[model samples]
Target: MSFAFTSRRLTTLALATAALGLASAAQADNKNLPVASDGTMPSLVVTSTVPGGAFAGHNKRGVALDAEAEFPASRLTAAEQAVFAATFKPKMAPYASAAEALDPESVINSDRRFRVYPQESGYPYRAVGLLTFNQGSGSFSCTAWLISNNTVATAGHCVHSGGSTGVWSTNVVFYPARNGGLSPYGSCTATRLHSVTGWTSSANPEYDYGAARLNCTVGNTTGWLGRAWTTASQVGVPIGIFGYPGDKLSGTQWGGAGAVAVSEARKTRYPIDTAGGQSGAPVVQADGTGPGTCQGDCGIAIHAYAASGGNNSGTRITQAVNNNLQTWINQP
Candidate 1:
């Protein structure tokens, strides 16, 4: 199958019109739901609030956390909190925090293929970094990569608490090029979030894909990655996985190289080293000749799960995701 990608143009008027269309549809669909402060389509609401004071926590990144770091009680209803509490909580990583551990060679010592991505790493991955938000127990982190001037792609679970719960994530923020607790390109909150209904409803791993629209166009300053689908041959090509693994130094950028071992219907397997915080890291194929190679490197999958055998897997990006991404990109 041919790889599909999102197209960007400089049509201000067209974008404005599309935004209006999305806003109208959102109102008709859920008028009771809150709309974005700018009168645009509101992000998916987490209706239930976490009881008691907001569960206070640290970002692992050394920077001081902000009010956005906590999920306010008014947004999420009590019912939603129960759904979030029921979600699986994987065991916490044992490795001590690798803060300020910029040298990847030292941290991923067990594996020769993995290395730390330096602070000055060039685009398009320079826009990839840790994504943080509030859930049931407390705050959590994942990986997210910029795809457009203001759009970030991450795993579905990071955006929505998929299952019958419909517990959408709240107070989400992105830290681009974060290295050892430092946000080199700064951070921003997600103005709008999008994810597949299959994942939101059934928690399907195959459909574990999501995107967030940032409050500002940070990608233009840091650059963003392109995305595409590929056949077995292209899929097998060596690809780079970038993210902040909880085990490696909380919120520090890490990089590793691995080739796709197999391509399933909607997922790809790789032996990339990753931990809990690495979820949503982009599995990106580097610049080369092929359908998805024209725009330097293109992201093909979203890092989602890992196994004890050292095998890590992600949700394959499909045409449906491409269409959703287009809808998000065109929104005002």
Candidate 2:
């Protein structure tokens, strides 16, 4: 299902920087945590009731610690440039396994320095926000965005703690177009969750992508992004990511735009600035012409991990994953 994108109301300059913590706002609502469904991981589970039942675990926020923020173009030697060019060539076959793939010539986008996102922007920023959930005695936070009216995409580890013994996260909430403590479109609890079995069972980073079905139809109000399975030839194409990062002003929303550094079947690497809470932020490319093109923006991948402090990577929305998202979105 598709909807028109809406502009977020901007707050006064002084109030814009004051960060709002969703966990604290809804902490008292913990008793209302939603009951865990019986369905298995990697499969979509849908619930009708509103989200609630907060647990006792502390809130875990994601953090990005990169000493070298963006890569320097002038510093790239001729040999390094050749390596990057070769590594990003279009592939003839699908990726064998994102879990075992190695990228030796990874680079970072230098367009944006790690910082806060402007309050008012276009569709890309409007579709992104903060996601918080109850884990044990505290709540953990990550970034997430709308791909459809009821579906929000994010990192699998954010939905289910990765590893062999991973368990689903409960009492999840999404705050779209959040600025400071303000939630422009309000917040909704996840009625259902979806992730790949590879991530839930083995904590495979390649399968880190995940999605949530919200009880609220926020898409009708704020609009949503479209999904696309990008190719290696599309590598270096400009993309933008808007999300909530813990290192920034008290978890306020922030964003950065850059090109795809590495494109593979399982994951896509870019220089977009992100941290812990930023996981799950949609890595989107401009879809079509004019304004509101390609249903606001085409979601290329789900931002999940970072390495060497230079490149922030995500689970590329391959054909298989794209099919899964469509299946989940079409579910009743």
Candidate 3:
């Protein structure tokens, strides 16, 4: 409910500035979508997907979206077209609900989590689910990252979907899979799920992120990533990311070896795809050193990169660190 626009509802909006009805490669200026260069930033007209369908919906449990075809556009501007191409694809991942395919009563680390062997030193995290309304039959899931055996961070939108109707709690769970192969499940009930005054009032995706204080350490597991950087996030940094993609399997590493990008939207183009299930993962960056993360990544540390990126293949604060849901989940 963070957005009025869901996969379920998408109505057309009339254009005011048809100045450039459709920007193309020929219009290099339009391609960049200049940010700080201009005194005023250009507002991007997004071609939103219809709500409640399978356009890009990832699967989890039993809730899934079926395959659907897209119509070619003749009314898109340059940026809209680019976003369309960037997001436009065939069969990314399957969508499902949490209980749908899970082996009920399965052990956490054994069946659920795909443990990640960190080559470098940094934090690891993942998302969880909380049963929702409708007689236990129709439930909504929220995303969270395991900070330790007990804490995590997530989007405020994940918790309170505006007002009493969408806000959810109870029976919360966490899954850590820096890799998509295996996933370790952990239980963490929601002790607190609040957002900034600015975030609640404004459905701003950037400000919509939130954090959760878990009741205990994530099953008392050791080697889980610790927390760092407590607020007012800095830009121009390269960030590592992780998440459980509902479309495909979990434990993703889709970008090529060291194909790094910035933490712009908290999402990047990578092969390790997740539709809706990969919500609430962490986007971390290195503190000391170890293994690294790349594009097509989610939920890792957040940082702007160093130049050249040979020894440090990090991303820029420009492309990668924009519109991110910056929150310190389970950061103690």
Candidate 4:
């Protein structure tokens, strides 16, 4: 897919100055922790569950990670599609494509997100999926990605109503690489959902992230993405966001890439085009060089909100978030 980027480049002198400023700040704040190792697991709260116990299969041992996208031999048969359609109703309420509270000018004028054809056959792409859950009387949809053999990371709001009076979502299901009525990898029900207290208590956007432990070890087949946390400024880091968008064809995965425009202590902003269902999409390192601070297919943030001032944003991976993810990924 093609991304629209301005031809402007930062000069060597400017780059040097920025680096020096960052170095000084890091030294002053002692923020130079090792990206992959510094995080300590934080306490997590259960936000939802599947009552009769959803666990069944044992996780595959020594499963190898796929370095590249894989294509399926064939699409689902008509009978299979019919069965899935009858059982899994597509009654998802559209997440707001653009946050109404934000300035309209903050949103990108052009929607550059491109559909991922045969998304179910792609590696990292397939790991990203459509998340549908029951929240009150309605079914709502969001995006999520596999971070472990049996767990997926997503926006906290996708799993919980948020705040002290918030209610946990129920009947959460994940359809990896779902394409319209085509569920190439089938789907898995989340047995247990997780979130942090900051969001569960105050609906804080900074803590607007969560995970769901699946009833199956599908990540062993699709392969999960790695995550990293860094104190360094992520501005200009090339990243891609891929997930199902409510505005596009239902259940279709769309994606786009762009450099981080603004990097704050807990959030990163970019101009990559996205819509409502795209929340919880992985903000992955797009250069293929891996994250400078972590190994493998590393993701740096969880895409959470729409354009605020001039760009869309995600909850940046920080030490606490990283630690919690590491712990969740290891949970049986």
Off by over 4 Å in 3: 1-137, 163-166, 175-186, 227-238, 250-274, 288-332
Clashes counted in candidate 1 amount to: 7
Error of 2 at 191 (Å): 1.1
Worst lDDT run of 10 residues, candidate 4, spans 1-10
Over the full model, what C-alpha lDDT does candidate 3 score relative to the true structure? 0.30
- lDDT (Cα, tens digit) per residue for candidate 1, span 129-218: 778886555567778988777788887778776666756677887877766545555678987777755676566656667888888666
User: TM-score of predicted model 3?
Assistant: 0.39
- State the lDDT at 215 in candidate 2: 81
lDDT of 2: 0.56
In candidate 4, how many Å is residue 158 off?
A: 0.5
Worst 10 residues of 1 by lDDT: 47-56
lDDT value for model 4: 0.64
How far off is residue 242 in model 2, in Å? 1.0
Better of 1 and 2 by TM-score: 1
lDDT by candidate, in order shown = 0.59, 0.56, 0.30, 0.64
lDDT of 1: 0.59
Using lDDT as the measure, the top candidate is 4
Clash count, one per candidate: 7, 21, 76, 0
